[model samples]
Target: MGEFFETYRPQLIYALIVVLSVLLLRFLTNLLYKWLLKQELKKYPNEKPKAVNWVKRILNALWLVLGVIALSSLIVNEDKYDILKHNFKLILYLGILSIVTIVGAASANLWFRVSINRKIQNAEDPTSFKFLRYIAVFGIYITGILFALLAFPSLEGIAKTALGGAGVIALIAGVASQEALSNLVGGVFIISFKPFIIGDIIKVTDTMVGTVVDITLRHTVIRNFENKMIVIPNAIINKEKLVNYNLGELKICERIEIGVAYDSNIDLAKKIMQEEAQKHPLILDNRSPTDILNGNPVVRVSVTSLNDSSVTIRAWAWARNYSEAFDMRCELLEAIKKRFDNEGIEIPFPYRTVVLKKEKETHKNHDAGQTAE
Candidate 1:
């Protein structure tokens, strides 16, 4: 028996020891964690406290991995091992994958804690900050996996071979999707530039008006006064005109068109409108306003169709707030009506001359028809 043992003694002994040690260690670790840490952890009941149990579990898992590797190595001679000798590449790749998983699990609790605290300390909106941090943590894990895939020697060679044509492939893809790429990049641009933040009133090209609800990578969300959201693509926004009301100087111009009887005092009408505008609290009077002038070829409010009684006038006033401007326009119109009524200034409507000859011509044509019949 001694002579027989001496032949395969070391190898047999190592195999037995590896197998026993792996099984015993795994059971012991599980028992220790369940009885010791898990019992205490269950009572404490907070994420950080519970994290310690996860740490122990990860350690147990790592121990199991190493034990398996050791037992497999002991079972076969290095040169003659069918799988171990031929598939060293697979073994290495799996080892890396296991390592990455263990690391990720072990650090997950720490990641959550640190990320949450960072968001809080930054004083950003808690919800947004948390969401961003969560995404960021996931991104880290994804990047870690990618790196692990590349780090394996077997895959590294293949990846290098694939990369040889990557440039040409990328060029073709780039040309084909240039606009799409621009839009994607533009989404990044919108996010970074902060042309408008959530809940800011904005206008684009004098057509759209709303409070910015969200700014995503590809699109902007706006909720207008009517409570309808308008989703505008970042590419469209970046390509065309945009105005962020939040950034503007908080003053806007409003125009009102008024016409007076040609015989009424035009100068008096101008004075009354100016006086009415100046009385408003929100009206900005720091800058002088101009009155209408005659003899403009392109008349914004010309003798556009000379009313038999009145000439037209268009007056503009700049106010501080949109609401204020709109309100003041109503008030200004009321004041103008009162002034016109008192002064008897006629704001006339268009009138056309209808000559009586038309009726007579129609009757004559009817008589001609009768004669032809």
Candidate 2:
């Protein structure tokens, strides 16, 4: 027992130092990450999510790197154990190569994630870049895992039957996950032909309303005007009715329907409407900058509905801004009411005529006889 312990003492110390180094590095990296995140949050107030994700992934990668380096060094020092000294050089090389490769892949993924997000921050379409990010991460992880698996000593069997069986097993596994394969293919289609992007208002159906907040392999994410998020399957979005506000001009039409008593002059009413519309500061007043005598001006009036008591004239104007449109509509309506009242024009209310049947002679006689009695 003494001899065995004596031989293993140096190896045990190396193992202990490796473990301690990795743990210490992990703690330090986490501390640094939080500090950096706080600093970034102060600079870019709206970049909390990006900063948080960046710091987290980078810290994890740093810890992974430290762990891999410690393990590689420890594995190389197995010679000092006095019993493992005569092992082939292949073991040491393999250990170092394997550890270095995994660390490299993780480092690449971290770099890609950070760099891509930076580019995306400046893009008109951030969702496309997000798809690229997913691809980068998946590629790195899968390549690393494949390399790790192939490096396993058991996979190097000399039997041809075993190699053939492994291939067959892989094929079977691939076939069994048909839906997963379809999702992967669908993700590719979605990225290549982007129907929508983040921050774009989209309508998928009659009721699903929101902005495209995120997209993933199996699902697309949407956040409604109420700040509620909904996850829809990619397959559904691929086949549903979708309208993208990102691709079109943002001009929205504000409409007003007004009517006046038939006795009022229609020309004067139209003139008053045109005057009210032009007074608002938000209305675009320039049609040609110079009026042509015969040229029909851009008339905002449309006598749309003809009701019994009044003729409903619809007035519409376009505004370049969405948030300002509703307020403009309200102002225009108040202006119209004040102008109409000033001009002695009444907005007619819905009216009806009641026709009473004529009383018969026999009823009149009965009433006269009662009075005489």
Per-residue alpha-carbon lDDT of candidate 1 for residues 9-101, written as tens digits (9 for 90 to 100): 997888788778878877887787678566545744454445446546665776676666666776577676766643555554555565565
TM-score of every candidate relative to the true structure: 0.49, 0.53
Q: Give the residue spans of candidate 2 off by over 4 A.
A: 1-109, 120-124, 144-187, 205-207, 254-273, 285-299, 307-312, 321-373
Q: Which ten residues in a row have the lowest lDDT in candidate 1?
A: 295-304
Per-residue lDDT of candidate 2, residues 202-273 (tens digit)? 888867878787777667889886789988877667778787765577666678779988788777888888
Model 2 clashes, total count:
0
Give candidate 1's total backbone clashes. 1
Decoy 2 TM-score against native = 0.53
Clash pairs detected, candidate 2: none
Q: Which sections of candidate 1 miss by over 4 Å?
A: 1-180, 191-200, 259-265, 288-310, 334-343, 350-361, 366-373
Taken over the whole model, the C-alpha lDDT of each candidate is: 0.63, 0.66
Candidate 1 Cα deviation (angstroms), residue 170:
5.0
